[model samples]
Target: MAVTQQLARVSGAYITRCRASAAVSPDADPEWDPPAEDWIDLDWSPRFLRDACELAGVDSPTLEALNYALNGDASVDVSVLSHPEATGGFGPTPTALTPASVADVAAKLAGLDWDRVMAEIPADCRETIAGGDFSGDPLAYLTTHFMALRDFYVEAAQRGLFVVSWWD
Candidate 1:
C-alpha cells in the first residue's frame, strides 16, 4: 500500500480512538487535556525500517535486532545500555581531563588562525560571523561553532601548537 494511504488510515483510527477515550474520561477538560489516544500504528516492514535507519545514520539490521530484543512477544535475556557510574547517567562518565588537557584546549583556541578558520567554516556560518551579530555577543558565535572548533582544537592539541588572530 502507498505510504499516504497507510498514514491516512492510521490517522483516522487514531482520531476514532481519541474520541472514544475522551467520552469515557470523567475529568476531560477540552482546554488543557490531550486528545485521548496519542500513538498511531505503522507497518514495520524491512524497507520502511531500513529507510529510517539510513536516515538516522545507524545500521538497519542492528536497529531491527535492538527493537526486537526490546519488545519481542517472547521475553528473552537482554542487557540494556546504561552507565553504572552515573545516577540516571546525569553525572560525568569517566574520562581523563587533566591539567595538561585544559592547557592544551586553551593553547589550541589561542593559536588558531582566524582567516584560515573562517575560510574553512560554512558560507552561511561565515556570513553570520562577518555580519557583526556575534560582535556584541561572542558567546552566540561560540555556541554555533563549538562542535567544529572543538574538533579543530583536539587535533591542534595533539600536535602541541596552533595559530590565532583578531578582526576589527
Candidate 2:
C-alpha cells in the first residue's frame, strides 16, 4: 500500500481537547478536523524531501525541520488521531509540533538552500530511495510539495498554531 503524508494546522486548545479525548479512550475514533486551508496533503513528497535534504547535507534546523515535517517532532502525541489501518499497520502515529517548533521550522525552511538541494537530488537519491523509486520529474515534484510544506509551516507559525502530521 502507498502511504501519503498529511499536515494540519490546529490551535493549542484543539490539541488539548484531542489529548483529553484520547486519554479518555485511546481506541476511539474521534472526528479530527481542521479547516481546509489549514491542511496539506503532501503525498510522498516528504520522503523525497527528507532524502534530498540528507543527500545535500542540509544541517541542523533545516534538516531537522524537514525531518519533523515528515515525521513529527514529538512535541505532542495523540494516538487516537491516527489508525493502524490508515498506515497499513506499519506507519507512524499522529504527532505534533508545538507553536514554538513550528516557528523554528518555518524560519529554518525560509533559509533553506533549495536550489542547491534540488540540483543534487538525482545524484543523492535517484535509484536508492530505500522503499520505492522516483517517478516523473522528481525535482519538479519535490519542488512543488516542498514549497507547499514550507508555506504551510510559515502560515502555521504566523498564526502561532500547532502542526500535526500523520501518514495514511
Candidate 3:
C-alpha cells in the first residue's frame, strides 16, 4: 500500500513502464518513429504528477485536472473543466492529446504553487520499495522527473504540439 500510486513506482527501470511523447500531430502509427527533437520520451509515469500535487495538499485544479485537459478527447466539444472521457475504445486514440487544446492545460498548470509543492518532497521514501534510490532525497529525485512533465506540457503548449501518454 505504500507504493500504491504511479509516482511511488518510478525509479530506475520501473519508470520505463510509461512514456510521454510530444509531436506536431497525434502520430497513431506504431511504425512511425517520431523524431527525438519533436518528442519528449520519458520514463516518467502519470502517477508522479498526481502524487506530487497530493503531497503538497493541493486540492483545487490538481494533477487530475491537468490530465483531463491534456488526455481528454478533442473531437468532443466539452467544457474545459469537464472530466476526461474515461470510457473509450481499446486503442490509444481515446487518451491522445492535441496541440490546439494545450493552452487551456498550460493555464491550469501555471496557476499551481510550485514552491510549496517542491518543498513537500521527503528525503527518504515512506514506502518499503526494494529498488532504486529513494534515499537521501526521494522527493528531490521525484521532483526532477515531475518537473519534466510540467515542462513537456508547457513546451508543447508554446510550440502548438501534441503529447500522448502510453505503455506497452
- Clash pairs detected, candidate 2: none
Write down the lDDT of every candidate, Cα atoms only. Answer: 0.30, 0.76, 0.45
Q: Which residue pairs collide in model 3, if any?
A: none
- Among the numbered candidates, top TM-score falls to 2
Indicate the residue-level lDDT of 83 in model 3.
17
| TM-score, per-candidate, Cα-based | 0.23, 0.81, 0.56
TM-score, candidate 1, is 0.23
Worst ten in a row by lDDT for model 1: 73-82
- How big is the positional error of residue 110 in model 2, measured in Å on the Cα after superposition? 1.0
lDDT of 2 by residue, 50-140 (tens): 8778887788667877787667775476566765532233466678888898898899998897888877666546555433555576677
Off-target runs (Cα >4 Å) in candidate 3 are 1-30, 69-94, 121-136
Sort by lDDT, top down from the best: 2, 3, 1
Give lDDT: candidate 1, residue 64: 44
- Cα lDDT tens digits, model 3, 63-146, are 655565435544532121111221112224323455555556666676676777767645453341113534444455555655
Q: Give the better candidate number (1 or 3) by lDDT.
A: 3
